[model samples]
Target: MKNYLFPHIFQPIGWIMFVLSLITGIAIYSSIPVFGAGIAETLAIDSAIIGIALGALFIVCSKERVEDEMTKSIRLASLLNSIYAYVALLVGCTILINGVKFLVFAVFNLVLFPIIFVCNFRLEMHRYNKMCEDEEQD
Candidate 1:
């Protein structure tokens, strides 16, 4: 099947967006004084969330520099792994958290899978690339 991934160029943009959004969200959540005068907290938080989601989407859906069969397989495996992780997290939250904290987690849960997938995918790719380099050096 054809993979309609974004160009690899988007990965860096995604990283930038993700980092900026995370910083902004954390600052807002922590009630940083710098953000006090300009924007509504709820609006800022929501925008941060949307930024994070878009960033993750761009990161996960972008094409690798070398899009081969192995990369495709790794992508599939990462996706499956992310789903498993997501379920485990959900179960853990359901069991261990309650009240407002649980609600907070529930809101963040929307972006969790994509973030997990990106981490898993990048780790796997790093490992595979290292193995290839080792083999080449042999």
Candidate 2:
């Protein structure tokens, strides 16, 4: 039963989201007068996909170890990327006493988070599952 449930519950959703984010992030980071420079189709697509994804995640996480572990693990890296960029810019602006654009920060993470996620997610998930297995053995 657990074996049967595993595939239904887990299939690299985090890793998939991470890839989608990278694609969208590149689009946003370009900042090239998209739909006339404020009317953002990019955000619309991204939010819609993310919303669907998050709902799916909750459903899976409610039942499966792998899904829950993968989501939480990838999020740790992604959130840190978000927070790091946000704080770094805020501090840099404060130090320079220069105004900072919110869009800069937005685009920065919109690009970086996925890159970080893709780089770290697979390894993290493997490690986490192994830890779970080890604990179960003990």
Model 1: what TM-score? 0.91
The TM-scores, one per candidate, come to 0.91, 0.38
Model 1: lDDT of residue 17: 92
- Residue 68, candidate 1: Cα error in Å is 0.4
Steric clash pairs (candidate 1): none
For 37-60, candidate 2 gives per-residue lDDT tens digits of 444775644663464445334333
* Overall lDDT per candidate, in order of appearance: 0.87, 0.51
lDDT of 1 by residue, 11-103 (tens): 999999988997887887677865555557667787788888889888878998898999989999999998999999999989999999998
Measured by C-alpha RMSD in angstroms, how accurate is candidate 2? Answer: 7.6
